[model samples]
Target chain A: MNKTLHIALSGLNAIDSPGPGVPVARGLREASGFDFKIIGLAYENLEPGIYMPGIADKVFIMPYPSEGIAALKERWEYILSVSKPDVVIPNYDAELLPYIRLNQWLKEKGVASFLPTEEQFEERQKYRLTEFGEKYNIPVPESHSVNNLSELAEKGKHLGYPLVVKGKFYEAGIARSPQEAEDWFLKISHKWGFPIIVQKYIKGEEFNVAGLGDGNGETIAAVAMRKQYITDKGKAWGGITVTDPRIMELTRHFVTKTQWRGPFELELMKDARGDFHVMEINPRMPAWIYLAVAAGQNIPLATTQLAHGEEVKPMPSYEPGIMFIRYSWDLITHVSSFQEFSMKGER
Target chain B: MKINPNLAINDTGFAFDPMTGHSYTLNSVALEIVQRLKQGQTEEEIATGLADEFDADPVIILKDLLDFIEILRNYELLEHE
Candidate 1:
């Protein structure tokens, strides 16, 4: 048992739209095997996870990813000089690019992180999801990128009506017509920038599986979920773990095929015919990750253990039917502390 | 300008307008400006105070303040006036 490892985590937004850090940290805290300090890395001072008592021993603000990779290095180098975390787990997709670039640098600095290679990241992107599915022989709904509204019709002919239009990074909207698709294309493109992805809308049950890859095509642990209640923003407000051999089989195939090296959430749909259609691949852990721990996988714990070079046996079975109901908590804080964190960049 | 009476804000930058049941996540600067607005500080006074505290042009700060107020109104977080 590692007695004192400092683990740094990012993406702590626990709002309507959440980041996975808080729940991931929850798993680490509940880990029966290790005692560690939780270092919260936030891009904004009010990320909610920073202010939540018992979640973060200390919190530090980081430069937004838009500031680019060089700035990321300088900022992280500074953060490391002071706190020197044993392992860093970034829970946001936007931070993955910079983290992949910083992987070797942090390792040299004695900070460990498990992440997918740059190639895996790119190939799994929405625009390339179809290509990835084709390469892996996995079933994926056909998707194409549209740079402008003019290109929507041409690019979306095969996709058909009631398709899903998604931003390159974050926003996604279902468009029932060309007009709605065009409107969403404009909205998403305006918000997340260009190269919007238009995908075939598969009407079925959405199942999400959160898993950790052992970097050599083996899945360390896997937990599948079915949302009992979906919020207006398309987030799962309540979900239950499920025992699906096919989803488990697909997860094994995916991680083994990609030699995936980190935490991943596979958003897949099961059509009437019982075939799994891969909708999207979230490169990091999902916000509902605590449920994985509740279901007995303890993926965050596995991830930290993997980062520390500990041998983790493959967790092949988990007690299914465990459910997680998401809720929002109000954390009372001080204006002066917020100001200090903002102006001084430490909390 | 004043914050809507039914609106509630937390130090963590969470704002909820119970009247409309809408919530917003404010940045630290926006929260500061919103707090001042709730205290009934005028735009000019808020801008001057911000400029004194942070390194920014008062004019730009006021302009940004107005923009923030406009956003507040759009979200129905501010009074009609």
Candidate 2:
């Protein structure tokens, strides 16, 4: 028998807690022929074994002595020494930069790192992926990168009311008018710095697809899910399996066109024109990963097998029209916070 | 608990209860337990059969079966016998 492939998932912060990553790991372990282990770098107390059973084989907690790139590098070195995984997959956007740096170090250490190249990373941060979509005739919203508040206001007016103001690299806030867009831009700029993108809000049904790409432009398995409900933070609270062939083909085309490697999720919104506009590409797993396993694609397992150069079988067809009610533990929590946040007159 | 005789369950795990206008999705294991319950099997007998079939501990199987029955009761899919 072939040796079991070992993998490590980084970034165990509170934001991208073990809650999300654990399911993916567990699904992989159950479905694929691999021995998966999660290496949580910070807050060992929040390790995977505590919450998620049968997912993490070993959890390595690194020293959290300080906060900075230098301290993080030290922790990475410690992690590399203790858990010598064949590949490292980062789980959060904030951790991407440091993991990229660690990837550079891994190249010298003779360990393979799975992440986008530096140039590709920079392009993604600039929303240049939209241009790639446009090349392949993938519908993208009318969006423009802006550097100042005046430019945001100008574009917002041009795009009309109900615009979405987003950071060039990440989700920021969705606003109803030019003033609201400007206010959102100012607030985010003050807190996280500038260069945001403002786009016309494409109103209609939204859908997201999760899949794994072979890096050679072949998508292994893909699952389409239509959002039945959404939280204010854009998390899918309820969804259902969709068997739309068009959505699947579009997702495959886009991922292949980008030559994307690793697990990816594409967010798409169907406009009033009945055209699907590409929203954004999350280069990691979504929160609803368990639903995918429950509905049957098992993307994390497929990705792990591909990473190990093992032959991955095609995903078996599953029943469509299956609805997933994401038990909303935090729905009440969000409602309370929204009330308090509104009372403060803050968006 | 009681199951409405009018309710129909398909082999593929789809359950339709006309009395409540509610449909349910049950895994194969849950479906099997529900079917046996509807066949008038006692809780202990159902647990014993499930334990033999799935190679699970009898106590754990009984607990899980009871929980499933409670869930069905809560959904109004079952009534007290």
Candidate 3:
């Protein structure tokens, strides 16, 4: 009997619908013909099976009731022992820390995992990335992480009007006027208890580049896209495939400079000067993995194959003008709120 | 609402705004709603027509139609008459 290669995915909550990891498993099955299993923790009802058929042999669910690290680690250890997967891949942002902590344990159990070394992981986080961008002549928004209104006001003056105040972890964009920014900071800071970063809003076209990197800092394959439509809450609703060699070179440069390993998504903004500013880096798969595959580059499959010590080749040509319209059920919900606003002449 | 004369709708549900080179793709339901609105059909009449044409519940179809109409209006694909 052939040994099965089980790929375990974390952060399988229904609320994080259409998780990025789902497509990775799907692509792995399609490209390499492997037996995959998914281990997800659900906070709510999630249809009770794998979203994509045949991608996972079985899905094991765990109840996640608290936000403590200890609770999460305990659950993770229990799931890892039960599944005993060949490789463990984390699908969400917060799961990275715990996954890194258990990296040694996973290695001892003969399961492969990809993460930065302990020192590198801490150095490449959001704050350090921002600082590194400045050092390398890479453009980044003027940002300051603050915890109080007094600090926010001082930072707002430096960043100018119409700044964005956002949590350091997990929370998305929240753009507001200086006063509103301060007010929101006070409210959310107390609730989330954060070191929130406030930055000057960059008015420009947004682009994202997703790629897989070897542990030795080699970019195996990559895809670039320009966000054509965005939701009010800052999710990319629709995106167009872009063919800018400069963007690709910049992405390669950033990844190599950071010496990053595993899968990564680099968020960038192009200013009027045509300079690509590095906004942030997601050290995981992006939400548009399917779109990237549709555009002729399958990063998920490439990552899996690369992890298995396979030599992956790059595409000589890709469809440049291809575009994707991401239609989610949530967009239907936005339609009703839009109608109510238009009725009141508020839009 | 009325269809903007400046905007062009192709048979394949490709929408083009001549003013701003922004192109959009509409699904089948959204395409039908836009077509009906262009033909100057009332919301009620369009809802009834959709219900009759597709094998779907009338109440759910109407709700979907109205919601799509609202999106079209926001995108300037429809103009209030």
DockQ of 2: 0.02
Please give the distance, in angstroms, between residue A22's alpha carbon in candidate 2 and its true position after superposition: 2.3
lDDT of 3 by residue, A153-258 (tens): 8888887777777766545455567768877687667755678778677777788887777767677767888888876656677787766777888877866776
Per-prediction DockQ, in order? 0.01, 0.02, 0.03
Deviation from native of the Cα of residue A147 in model 1, angstroms: 0.5
Question: Where is the poorest 10-residue window by lDDT in model 3 chain A?
Answer: A43-52
Cα lDDT tens digits for candidate 3, B1-81: 677766678899998754333579988877888788778888888888888888667788878777877777666466536
Question: Which segments of candidate 1 are over 4 A away from where they belong?
Answer: B1-81
Which lDDT values do the candidates have, in the order given?
A: 0.88, 0.66, 0.66
* Alpha carbon deviation, residue B5, candidate 1 (Å): 57
Query: Candidate 2: which docking quality band?
Result: incorrect
lDDT of 2: 0.66
Lowest summed lDDT across 10 adjacent residues in model 2 chain A is found at A10-19
Instruction: Give residue A281's lDDT in candidate 3 (0 to 100).
Output: 75
- The digit string of per-residue lDDT tens for model 1 on A1-347 reads 44699999998788898999999999999998689899998987788998887898888898899999999899888888888799999999998989999899999999998888899899999999889999998889999988976789886676789999999989899999888998999888888997899999999878999999988988899988887789888899988777767888999999999999899999988887668888999999999999999989999999998899999999978866677888877889999878988998887
Give me candidate 3's TM-score against the actual structure: 0.70
Evaluated at residue A167, the lDDT of candidate 1 is 91
